[model samples]
Target chain A: MQNLNKPNFKFTPLQIVQISVTVFVILLGLNLWTFYAEPLSKVLSPYWNDNLIDILVLIPAVGAAVAGTLLTRQFEKGETPYHIWQAFTIGLWFWVAGEIGGMVNDALYWDTIYPDFSLVDMFWLLGYFFLGLSLYYQLRLVYGAKSRSRRRIYLGLVAIALLVSAGLTHLAIKAGLGEGYAWIILFVTVLYPVFDLTEGATAIWISFLFGRGQWSRPWWGLILFALADSVNTFYWLGGYGFIPVAAQTVLNFISVIAYPASYMVAGLALLSNYFILRYGENSGLLKVAIKSEINKP
Target chain B: MKYFFRQIEDIPLDHSPVSAEVYFRGENATGLIEKQFNADRVAALLFISGTPGMAYLIEASQSKSISLAEFSSFADGVSHTRAINLPDVAGRLMLLALESKVNDKFTITTEEAWDKKISRWKQEQRSGLVEVKSKNLHGFIFFWQGELQKLDLIFSTPQGFVSGFPKLNALDDSAWDVTTYVHSASAQAYQCTVLRQGAMYWCHKILVRYQEMVGQKLLKMMDRELNRQMQPWHWNINLNENDMLDTHFFPYLMDEAHAYRALFMAMGAQMNFVIGNNLTQRLLSETFEQIRPDERAALQSQRLIPAAFSE
Candidate 1:
């Protein structure tokens, strides 16, 4: 992660435009993956099983995600608009993390004789998890403002998020105790929303603090939130695919309804803050600020 | 004229001109208006712009046969013909400051013949001797002697030389040529380049204009207005002082929505101009120039730009 306090760094229109193109490419890749997953799997699986292929795909995906994360950091460092290597790596990691998470779930639940718990598979998941963790922490390091209070606030937030996510996962798994662990399913269900909200908030805070004139964090946070919610909306609208209509509607209510509403709430909070700054100075304070500025060389 | 005054009772129509005066009491309202008019009469317009307590003079005239136009040639310059008049008193005053260097007579054509009429009428045959008359005016006309090389609005109102030519050309109200008209309208051309460099530049030319007009009156008014409209959000500002530092805004999302809503509400009563998308997009695009790309995409996808701000 790059330090944000460099005087020479500035976000350019071209950079924003390039970043947008990269985002578009990522979205396109995801769409293609969703549409051709099975057909692509059939062709590739001739040499490997479906599960192995899934893990194999993670190699490039996780790499892309890491690279993309690094690219973001580099951009902040005023290196260039984007580094192709970084973008590709970050993109790769994003895909790998999801795949690895799923594979871990499969290994835990569906394996017979405990599947002897393949070291390679386990290592891969752990690797991807750490990669994601690193990316997140690096993001904070590069973009987060350096203030003691802010650091404390962010740390507190992360702690709360992890605790809440873990607790919810525990409850879900406990409910299905005797029927089998099913911990992965519980973890995912609990993980998505908690991380989404936290990531969104963190993104905004980082942009406010370090981006200064850049839009990287805010754009990503908003687009990601919008995309995530949109997926739920589309899925629900498609009759929840295989899920029961009632359950699907409930999921839709939380993701489609509550998620967007929360973003709006956050946006409103920022606006209120701006209003206060623009309008809440006392006469004496205002005079002092003006006089002080005038008194400056 | 009587008919025009009657229309004043219903002034500021969404589509056509409304006959009433508009008042801008909010802190930034004057600033906003000054940016638009570049004149000292923002407060003057405030007496006319709609308010809860202010009765629509046109509305009052509506029941009768009186019109606002009757007063334009006779009373104050509040009539329709003058409503559209360029080089108005305030505008002319600023023009004097610029014209102080002008000595020779040159042809000055306006896009609108009316502007030409007003300009010619106000032309000083002798330096400092331009006798512009009408029962509606209340100031002495001063002309700076020099060759009329250019139109300058910096010292004048927006209607003065800055917009004088453009207003005339825009009589057809078709395309507004920035080069031939007002140069200040294109102030955001470099903003895109600035953003590309990761730097943000905020130009508050209008805010500066407002500060010059009524001291801190508008700022104080805005604070009070916020208090009234948005309770629970006690904006801590001393509204009694004439200091810019005392000015602040509690820019919450709701406030953004409200500000937009108020702007639209006012604009909607005027005319629906196709700004593409929705009213919000139109307003932001026109005022801010650079719209957040995501926001633009979102609105375009949603078809949300209102057609009022284009006008």
Candidate 2:
């Protein structure tokens, strides 16, 4: 039987370091430019937190587009798995939708935009759907044809996540928010986090199955992304007074850092995965140890 | 026409001689013959005639015990069905007359003569005498570790060469006694006997020829689908004289077109036919469903049949 599980290659240690440093430098430079440049900040002041949009949404969205395009081209040439290319394409569309929604929100300048259900929420919901789909495809590729057992486990976990998120939403509703903002709060505070939690948990599960030795770099990157999303969720709930504000200042700083960090890490993960597929064999990073036991002479 | 029979209870076990031989003369005699001794035992031989496609010879063999009377009866029955005319029945009538005269020396001479005739017969079959049909469909069967790994089908149409492969599970755990019938509207009918042992299913012998045009088309299709250059005509296993004694060879039969249609119909009925593309799947399903129920059932049965049908 063919060993389909083996990758073509992997990144070298130096390449890994170079990629990490490049991402860090880019993010740090963008943050410094946004915060310290007086002339730019004054000019963009009219555009509803242009700095936040640039850092949290635009940069990562572009990265996703690039990664998605590369994956699609590879798929057309029969160089990548069908599911992987499909997942990336969906991710690209998700980002495009979100970017459009962000622009719309900025133009309107609605006061209730942050904690309210609006057209932006619809885009975000769609984004969640695509993200879930991407994760599902990745899991399917890993599991292969004899996937009945693994699929049951995955579905079970998804059920648990739904239950947990539903319970959290119920508690938040009981805490007594105004009726006018209840639906909005339910969507933003409850639904968004539920999607994030489920997607993150599933990604973490897939990464775990990939094993620590073979794909630890991408695994760590995924963990960072998942952690950032979780932190952002907790921060949103805290702001809505769904949790006790014991360490409010510290939580606020963490949330601020995490929101942008999640997007950056996800972009990096996409880039790294593409590199692994393209250059792992040449770099000697992606070696498939033949299962001698399965194939005995 | 003379017929002879010799039975040895304690035959010298060094090397088993050719089991059976046949020689024929006529217009329709320029074809192959396949016969099944029982449900699990099958024998096939090609016999294209020499010099103006007349006077053909055929040989059949088995490793197990067989009734000579039953064998003679089968040949008689096939000759009747096929409307073959035998000039004189003196040889067949002499079986009882020569039973007492059959000694080790006579058995050795008969075996040697049959072997020599079979060698010449194989050479004649390989000669460029058989007609090659243009724009005909072709099929290739691949085996790995004695198991049927894949079956590739390529059809030559005015539109282009259309090709597809059935899913892996299509031949999974196939019975050893399964016989794949190959026939088309414009081709002589042939049969491939499948043998299974343990988890592996394979053909002990095959007589289909490979077409270069079909191979080229298959290569192109594989390249397009996989984005890799593949030589569809290349056989991983050796098909030389040494290998022929043990391993099966993909027979290159003459004048057979659309042979894959019969094989696909037989296999599709027996196993799940998962085509790589959906359009091909939809197109082929109707044709696959048209296979006769008895034909389908013959290939599907796990238990061996009392008699195996061969053409």
Candidate 3:
């Protein structure tokens, strides 16, 4: 076949896809194995599930750092691409720090969970700030030509974030969610949904902007993260009897698979971004990433 | 037509008004014109001496709005016949200097040859004029205190700024000129490079931001990297001092826009490596954007920022 004559580099994309899929399967399988498989479910329940979450989340976080290092070399340091990758790198590691902290904290208190305002939240929150910076630069690069539209996009995303976060918070409070917790804990507890929804909106927008390309998967990966966090928030809001029977079953399903799935997707997203930029750039996608050819309005 | 230049009778040693003195004057120099180039061979090869030099062919035909061009730029669409009659007191007050004292001892053809010669000259601490008398290639280059100064090597002599340096491939000349020994002292050859007025603010901003971002030690390392990349391209822009950019002189480059782009590209790269790229790009965009619209327009007009700063 003529395909056989192609250079070895061509297969890298295939290899990436295969390896990522394998990782996703293993992680997701480990998280879900307790439910479907007979005796293995009992064995893996708390210990293996915790381990899976750590591995899944850390993979993407570390991947972001490594990707940042590699991709930084490819671009001129003071360029848009360089800034975007660096921000992402720093931001992702912040999440990793939080994850590591949470893991350690959990290990120390095997029997009990930390309070609502754990130190881990601090790292995760800071991660959002840097991650926001990366997105700022990333959007700056594309929207330079006729940035009025870009301004509108910003306004629109912000409005959506505000509306959704307000609605969710109100609903969360009304459902007797914070009745027992301290008011301070309640304030922090509701912040996750706000952040997650904002990021979800942005990721969905970015996904649409990029279309169904190799790069879109990473945004989708973040979407999973947002989805998982939202699910966690929903469950906290006295979700019992709050939903239809079928919908409640779906939420339960989401609860089981969502976090692990989010970590796997998000981590792989970072690694994939690196691969796509470095080795999978033959598709002319990076040009789109750094410079937008969208017609001026 | 034939033109012969008669050397001026020696002026008193104290009389050093380079603009007024006619060093070498010729007559009927048009007939000696070589066909390979455009522009009429002017009646005189006016041999004037100073730091970085400028040459003008003030045709007798166009005495009205007389213009002076840099020595390296050739005037096009004119005939040798027009240059037969030279105009005096026209384009004369303007100052363009050449290295008066030629040290033609080290004649070089290729750039590779020139590199070795320059190194030898540096080792020997040689100082004199390096004359380029190859057919139509007439540059009065000089060395000062073991260094062939940037003025003699750049295109900034005519205008205040130079775009880029000339590469060996860009030479387009067959034989290199001789290095004639004239001045042994370094006093005369110390012509400071002139930079564009508005380019000052931006260059200062860039260098300062870079310094602040990368720190002094790494900044020196970046300077070394810049020179390393620029050397192979036949440039001698020494960025040892950051002050040079803010003052009247920025280490100038001479020649095409593409060559200038390479210098900027290299500089940008060094900045990125030393500092995070966001700061680098942000500094560039922010500085460029913050300047007055007129200043920005002036810089863009001069193409002072290379396409490497395209983003």
Candidate 4:
């Protein structure tokens, strides 16, 4: 008899993709129905408030957090590297913070002139900081001590890019909001997009370094996330008609898809990453398939 | 003709069976000899050990069924009880006696000298007739004095026997002794050694160099087998002190079923356990009892051994 105490909970790459895509589609469908579908919107009009959207977004964020925690436990049990779990945990925590902050705004119905630069915005900034920190740690794992100079150069390049983007965002925010806006509101608004752009850039860079052959799934997911975040920045700017009329018209269309797509893509990336760590070709969880394409030289 | 000799009781007087019925001795028993006897019609002898004056009975029985007194006379004539010096030698004598008892048409000349017989046996080994059967890593069994003996498990590879535990060089001469050759593959012999701590069999140890070399080889093989670009050694170098001591080092031992599974995967082989003989199955159960609770639990968690192997 096989031992009941020891359970082999392993999944294949195709299975992982299938499960993740299904979850993503269901969540995206629900979000679309809540916003755009009139019949369902009327049915959920009372129950599906902004607070419900907050919980809906929180589901994936919290699920990623839980998956990270489980992966950490598995690392301890199986002696796998802890850095993979740590990266997801840190990134998921940031998402949780951003979601919680949004949930609070919807729950309390805060009415301030510059809602963009409220206490909730501070949490969002802190969330992005942790997400960036997680990526930095991940980069360190990829490039060990031998490439000290190269890592330094990479970090320097990221800093320069972040600064240039931040400067551009600051100028755009000033032009969009007008001189009547407080300096603090302008600074916070500019910082938000800058954090998102930095995270997107970092994800792309990491994907470029390690993503090849069979490892392309997570890379594709990261690229989608980066694109979604880039589109989201324009959506945020276009909300107040700060963007030019021509760009605003494009932003309005992009915003419809990009906002929900960002969370879904990020969730998919985290799930795919978890599978890679837990059941990758090298993980010994699957039967040895010498003839498989992944095993080809 | 070269013969592989082992002791067996209750040989059928009516039937002339070609194969040998040798009882499982220990890990050191010649697996190649057993396989040859089973596969080909290689000659084999089975006899009881510790019987008094049995050598004389064997020698005289070549011509006729000699009386017990004549057997005693033949034994008394000899200056030494040659059979006592090496009880295994009696197996050769028993074969000669059996040939006489059967009154076979062909006359077989038995080598009288003990050293000559041993030399002949060694010569027979190189003839390519002997085939070594591959054993599952966990199938090692040892028996002494009709009782199951606890043994230190060793992994048999083409190079040599890989000891599962580290040996301390400070041990005295009496503490260490090579027990027997266990299993072999592709004409390569894998030997098993017993380490004694006073009266108790403690732990098994292999050559430190062989251990390290095999570990390195397995790592490289695993990388190739999995088609992994990043090697474990590269990651292992950067591992923190805690991970190095606990997680990574255990698999290097390779005696544990979990470690064996990893090594076999590298070799592109799947590991499965066979229960072997009934005595060994019981002894293995007892050996499992000797293991620490946590260690036993860890082995159980790997689930490498099939339920049939345990039975």
Candidate 5:
């Protein structure tokens, strides 16, 4: 009887155009960042590529990811605009940090290590990281959730530890403390991504299996971030040669289909489960018993 | 003519049609139009109440009358046994009709599919009359039109609300007739009734109170029928008030009278209209009161009791 099909509001022509342009700019910026900035930093100083970029970008990215998790918690409470803003902020900060790391790596680290590195190259690298960071964070913050103080504290601590570790790793390398200790600091920086990815995945799996399905909002955001990171990594390094590229292209095609295909599968599962849930119950106790059985191992 | 039923299913998808039709007339114009224009093309497909995914079209043409036993079997075949709760069969049928029309060509736009479905079923079915029947978990007699037999009236005693329908083949029956033929299989009988009186009363009240925007004529017809049947009778009083009454009532003076059989006829009529099937010929055939009680009893004797329960 009620018209559930109608959306709350229709987008105007100008709004549609704006969104299209924003999306296009974001995409172009990302390609430039990946193709130019990332490679240039590595070319300038191979040693700094592995460690410095992780410090500047990786830690902040982890913080942004944690912020996404916090925002999801807010969303469950029915906070809409606040949730969206928080998610955006988390994504923004993480991306900004990552870009700064890239810029500092190219401008300061490369210039110091290699006398041939020019300021023009440094500026280009800075612009590249800035553009890429903006694009990634913009995408991440789409779902917007409320910010949590505890998460903020945790992210700050992580940032402080990363900066201190980066400085210590640089000092130790200059003193010839050897690659073993530098690798230890490198491992610390890597922990940011590793921990965020693991937490996000765990939250998603747990919510899906144990918690109400509605509670999986944060998990979805994290999953998206993890997926994007993985894809970007593969794309940036040009990891695939001609043979791998062909294989991956096919895989990507399947993956694209796979995304929408999952929805159809989910719909069927829901319909079957609906009948079972709606009719099978006799007494209230029987309903409880049935639910328990469904939840069983 | 399309007859609308309420609260057909517990869960409805974001986009799904919800209506059914019963054609008593020999023609299947509605069925033809639906097949020609599928409804799902414009809208995303949603599940039918009991069926797996919405299959859409169900034709209850006069060419093939679905008996109570067959109705139960067809319903069971579609619904998974795990979920035993039955949705309103009439409502489910309408939902099926809506789904059947879904296709790329038929539903080019939302209004094209939805408004068109509503218009065709309602407009076409109103011109004719059809007789249909439905059932419940426990045995009781209810109908969209007609009278209840005495024995059935007593057996299906309602704690609060009650309704009845005459058998499709037995419009001539009198409830007061004292004979074994009333209850016997050879007499006019029915397996179940369609609209439960209690539920219908509630539905009527809600519609009248909430959906005042619907047609006034329909509201008046529903109200007049409700008031007529709801009268408390300490003495025998002919409840018929309209000059051209399609339904008749007979009080059972003896225990042998069969109200259940009469109730089935009325339910069948309701089902007929609900599915957008024509029923004018059946309603106009020999006046409602002209059918003798003996003729009604004779019709009951011909009905076959299934080897097992209808469920």
Candidate 6:
């Protein structure tokens, strides 16, 4: 509860980067170790815990939640930009709640991976509502100012995304993952990738428009989040082994490594934004204020 | 910040008996009035007879009561409740003399009538000041508490400036233009006082506070952006490194409130571009907080600036 406006009050940008990278590595290693360790030795067996990864996601997710609160509090609440960011923060909190729900699921039923549908999925899916709102608001703000070429470029990029997602889905269906699955289950599972792709594409466009501007970095986190979620969508559809038997060993050896890491990275991005706006190195207001003070006659 | 001053409420009053040095500033009589009052269109007069010794004289206007709503345009420069004490008789005579319509030749001889009226006004127990203007003399006759009190004079001779009451024989009155201001001896007394200056002080404070709270370095580095934003205003003023306006706002004497508001808003919009709206607004509020509470109160009362001047 140090004063928020004081110069250099919190973590530096380097420290934020270090924390994100460290958390990502730990999440990835633990997730990979769970799948890879059992084949190697009993020594690693005692150390690996599948449920721990579910709980560990809260570390970054909660950090993201705190960053959101600061963002909403520090910025002018009535502004359109802040409203958009507030929507994004709400989406992030929904994801955090989903992670917490997953932890509860793991604690309650040690054997089950997840029920066909559960409250956790509901939380994660609801997060898309807020993410969609934020993306829509941002688009509306920049929509009027965009040139014809820029709009065409956005549409072309989106079309390209659609083709890539279609190809990935085709690969899963060709491997028979979609063959006997219930239509409802397939539809629900497909929704995650759809939302992720839309969010990622819109974020890319926003970043492009704001180049070297204030909003440039905030959307980058959502892009990372979308990528990780896309990979998880395949895992959920049981498409891992569809590539080939030659790659089956590595395929089966991957145990949800990217999912938590993605969440951590997203959280790290939000934290970094909050820190940079108020106190992070090279960009914080306090440092600039001090510099101005020094330069004065 | 959401403040505006449609009408100037306070005329910076020099209540003390002004010294000859401070009032005339050693300038020759021909240019003294123009230098002091013409820029802001504010005319101030001081009389030495009364205890509360300020005779505020607003130059005569066609519309004695103009709406403060038109204060933004400041079409005629002087429009405020304080101006409700319209020039009347005394105000007109001062204005006519200051207008230099009569340098030395005039046959409107009120000399005999001037002494007679003073005696009559004393008998009637009327309290006010009489204004006498001539080619070389700007004379004031003070009446305090229904009594003839003092003679204060400023001699605007080509020989140079001389001040203070002249001896009885020293006054030669073949022809004179004389008028009287009947003091109401009530609360509605600040009518003729014009308030056309002091905007520079507020503008300076805005810059200094912004420098201290948010960092003027950001504004200093934005030359291209400032020029781009200010292109519409077409102003050629002295804006310093901190984006502080230095004394070039005199042209806005009639509408200083709106003029400075435009400057304030432009700088604020630039800050938003740099840091974003939240911190920009927060910093703006902090900068506005630098103004003293009383000054802010006065400004706000006239809608010159917002309650806290927050964005």
Best-fitting candidate, scored by TM-score: 4
Shift of residue B86 alpha carbon in model 6, Å: 25
Binned by DockQ into CAPRI classes (incorrect, acceptable, medium, high), candidate 4 is incorrect
User: What TM-score against the true fold does each predicted structure earn?
Assistant: 0.28, 0.43, 0.43, 0.45, 0.23, 0.44
Backbone N/Cα/C clashes per model: 101, 13, 20, 1, 64, 8
lDDT of 1 by residue, B132-216 (tens): 2122211223322221212222112222223222232333333221111111212221121112111111112212222232123
Candidate 5 lDDT over residue span B124-243, tens digit each:
432111212122111222212233322223111112112343232233212211111112122111212111222123233323321121122222332333333323321111212221
DockQ scores for all the models shown?
0.03, 0.03, 0.04, 0.04, 0.00, 0.04
- lDDT of model 3, residue B106: 43
TM-score of chain B of each: 0.19, 0.19, 0.38, 0.17, 0.20, 0.34
lDDT of each: 0.33, 0.37, 0.49, 0.39, 0.30, 0.49
> All candidates: CA RMSD in angstroms?
22.4, 18.0, 15.7, 17.7, 25.6, 17.7
For this target, which candidate reaches the highest lDDT against the unseen true structure? 3
lDDT of 3 by residue, B125-195 (tens): 77544544343333444455577644344221122223244444453656655545453223222222122
Task: Say which prediction, candidate 2 or candidate 6, comes out ahead on TM-score.
Answer: 6
How do the residues A201-258 of candidate 6 rate in per-residue lDDT, one tens digit apiece? 7887666655533445567667777766665666676677577765555444332544
On DockQ, the leading prediction is: 3
RMSD of 3: 15.7
Tens digit of per-residue lDDT, candidate 6, span B76-163:
4333222111112232223323322222222345545556765776788654445555544544444544565322223332233344
When summed lDDT is taken over every stretch of 10 residues in candidate 4 chain A, the lowest stretch is A288-297
Residue-wise lDDT of candidate 4 within A1-297, one digit each (tens)? 111122255755556657777876787677656555544346555434555556666776676666556545434332213554465566666667778877676656645433646666766666666566656755654444356987797688668756776676577665765466666666666666666666677777765544332222233434555566667665665554665788755754565455556556655555554443444444333343343212111
For each candidate in turn, the interface RMSD (Å) is 19.8, 15.5, 14.7, 18.6, 23.3, 11.4
State the lDDT at B231 in candidate 3.
Answer: 55
Judged by lDDT against the true structure, how good is candidate 5?
0.30
Better of 1 and 4 by DockQ: 4
Off by over 4 Å in 1: A1-147, A177-193, A204-297, B1-311
Worst 10 contiguous positions by lDDT, candidate 1 chain B: B194-203
> Candidate 6: what is its chain A TM-score?
0.68
